[model samples]
Target: MSATVQTPTTRPQIPVTVLTGYLGAGKTTLLNRLLTEEHGKRYAVIVNEFGEIGIDNELVVDADEEVFEMNNGCICCTVRGDLIRIIGNLLKRKGTFDAILIETTGLADPAPVAQTFFVDEEVRAVAKLDSIVTVVDAKNVVARLNDSHEAAEQIAFADVILLNKADLVPAAELVALETRLRTINPTAIIHRTERCMISPTEILDRRAFDLDRILAIEPDFLGEDAHEHDDAVTSVALRETQPIDVNRFNQWIGTLLREKGLSILRSKGILDLKGSPNRFIFQGVHMLMEGDDGKPWGQDEARDSKLVFIGRDLDAVELKAGFAACVA
Candidate 1:
């Protein structure tokens, strides 16, 4: 008898979809819809709330594993670290879940969270970033965009723009909102949703963050002027080779957020920890912090920490100094 040889099959990494928008933009409503739908794939949802009230849902199955609520009240501030920890924990019970859906606070920017999947080696290995779905309130979108940088970035980074609460606006108004969104993000797939009801399948696995598209939008991804931005809003990337003193970093971050949270739109970091082989992941919005341990370091890996901050009129010098103080 001839011996049979079998090749091992490698499972594809699960994709994580980030849902973001301004406060009261119907993120929770959309999440609730997804949770109830019979989509064949089991999902692990991470909902970051900006207040102390927990999500009071009765339909959630496997409550602990299926629904994770970051009660930090600052979605952008605390979600990145919470995400890493939650995802890491979920991975340990592999096969129990199929995908991850993170719902950012309504007034939060989604870029920092989206960047987390790419910047963190351990995170990248375990999960792939699928898409950023921004739920826009049709009735208030124009005013929100005019009033907040967070609103603008949420729309700008979206792979899929869900113009939720479309019924609240007139047909003409909705059309105008669509046009404005196109002007900001010409390539995003736009969907008009009533009461935040849409097929989950429509949003999943849609590799929306195409590098070519981003380049087309910015046209300066690699140039020295890439970090430059208009008044009120900017994006900055910070990097270091040394591990961070986690406790000091936390204290510094806490103080920084408390003092300047209103100015900072979003902040996220993939830290190389001092004396620890595992990477520490953290993300925050204004005054919230969430973090957790990631996978072990590989021998060929470079131990470095990289963080990205997106905000309004951020003083780079002071921001860099604060990070330097955390260095081991």
Candidate 2:
């Protein structure tokens, strides 16, 4: 007797795009462009502001979360924790919006924010990270790139880069900026826009990030020893076949972030938990940490935990030991 086969259905999750750039780098303008665009997709905007006064009330589509004002004037530094919480809450109201666009403050690096999609279990389950779209100010690209590590990383990790305010720069200068950006990241799709205006299709669902690309960017990431790069950046990856103690893992994460938040740029992992059949995901940028349950394990799935850390001058020995403490 022949058996009938049922086709698998694909339920596509909405993607969340994190828009970041240096201060006054046209992030807001690009956001406004997205909001006002005639495109049919509805987006729920999460605005992280530096000051208590919210000036762009007219631009906000729906104020789901109060503008989380950070003390440091940098969204990555001050509002990262708030971002995790907001995203978690947003996931609960999944039917209300088609997609999510998070506008980070200038001076914020995109790595930590991107890490959230991989680490936080709840956020990961509901929202897939679509892209890290960095808007570069064409006129001041050289200066910002020279002065800020955050600016450089934003460009480095971006899947799509918008050279905004292109009209302000000469053609030759813009070309030079493109060359510089290529050296930092050769794979990102570059778009030159005037006043941060570009087609929405150009930015969304680009699938710019890949594990292989990330590993290539930090080759020593998977190595056993700690490797430090320029600007005191370091990467370490931990892998284990054993499960982790949930309580110990939570404590270690809190302590590590509290003490080394400034130095820790990004950390993420798929964890094997003692009592959980599904994979547990953990991710953080600076002080913000988020995790959630991942897909269920199949009969042939490998039960192992793999975590990667990228930061400034991180001590590999100490990190490994701390992670080991979480072992069950």
Candidate that scores best on lDDT:
2
Q: Any runs in candidate 2 off by more than 4 Å, and if so which?
A: 1-11, 51-79, 208-328
What is the per-residue lDDT of model 2 for residues 131-168, given as tens digits with 9 covering 90 to 100?
Answer: 88999889887777667687767876677899999898
RMSD values for the candidates in order, in angstroms, are 10.6, 8.8
Scored against the true structure, residue 210 in model 1 reaches a CA lDDT of: 33
Whole-model lDDT for model 1 versus the true structure? 0.69
What residue pairs are clashing in model 2?
119-282, 119-283, 120-290, 120-291, 121-291, 121-292
Query: Per-prediction TM-score, please?
Result: 0.56, 0.57
Say what the RMSD of model 2 is.
8.8
Q: What is the lDDT of residue 152 in candidate 2?
A: 68
lDDT string, candidate 1, 136-224, tens digits: 88988878877787787887667789999998889998876776666555446799999888998778878633322322333122244
